[model samples]
Target: MKYSYEFYRDHLEMLRIKLPGEIELFADFIEDISIEQKADEYITKVENVLNGLYQDFEIQLNATSVLIKKDMTVLEHFYTYEEPYENEMETEEFKELMLIWKSKIPERFKKKEN
Candidate 1:
């Protein structure tokens, strides 16, 4: 479940502009995973999104796997064939990747000190 992520500066910049409101939540998700008590809370949020209890974000749970994308439509091709994303990673690996990406965000986008 290890992932090889490409650190794209432009993608980070794009998220900074497009998902300004989600930045804090994303950061908190990363932080919550590191804390014992809060980890379940973070997982619950993700599960809510995956299970359709929440629909505010772009995330999909197909069978036992999860997909996070900007556009759920992009998953059509994969769904038709019941395929996992080419870039699929385990949850822990995904958390690690998020941490790396979070570190690259410019200081201005961060609402609180890490």
Candidate 2:
């Protein structure tokens, strides 16, 4: 499956207020997937959240899909604002998307190697 996303000013502003620094963390997670081989733990985190084992965060990732449920309170407020937005992609497509997103991250937000 192919995935696409558009972020409006309001959406970004809301995210900045509601989930500060999450973008950086997300970038780190993307890098970790490649550098640290965290796919298993990433899948476990997704599974745990989906199974109600934990509520550590709103975003979840598994082998096949990426789900982002930022806020359910105002579902469908915007055409782009789908409650619990999910993208199911083949492995290659998903990896491509991750790299694309990783590339878009601002230089200051990228993780520094020791």
Candidate 3:
């Protein structure tokens, strides 16, 4: 998929406009929705949800780094970024944050819980 830096910037903008708890709600929606065997509005909503997760990561990375352009498929941004500095605290904190964004999968799509 093609991910643009501007798209990521927009996603982060939504996070700043929203409270953190509401941000988590969006994250939960992404984690809960399945891409397989779905169509129409649900797929669109889930894709939007993933876009939000990508935006959160961009915001966190940009907050700590110069945000120079770099190439990485796993990221989104307005500019490419090199990896930011890391200490245990930051790593642990990022992991915690990502848990809300990326920490769910099922045995299969059919097993998805409501």
Instruction: Pick the TM-score winner.
Output: 1
Alpha-carbon deviation at 40 in model 1, angstroms: 13
The list of candidate 3 runs beyond 4 A from truth reads: 1-22, 25-94, 100-103, 112-114
How well is each residue in 1-114 modelled by candidate 1, as lDDT tens digits? 243333222333332311122121232223223333444443454455556677623433332223442122121123234332333323444444445544544442334423
Model 3: weakest 10-residue lDDT segment is: 1-10
* C-alpha lDDT values of all predictions: 0.36, 0.35, 0.27
Off by over 4 Å in 1: 8-87, 107-114
- Candidate 2, 1-114: lDDT as tens digits: 144443222322321111122122232234334422355454455455545676433433332123422211111111224333322323344344445544444442334443
Better candidate by lDDT, 1 or 3: 1
Residue 48 accuracy (lDDT) in model 2: 59
Model 3 reaches what TM-score against the true structure? 0.20
Worst 10 residues of 2 by lDDT: 69-78
Query: What's the residue-level lDDT of 73 in candidate 3?
Result: 14
TM-score-based ranking, best first?
1, 2, 3
lDDT of 1 at 80: 33
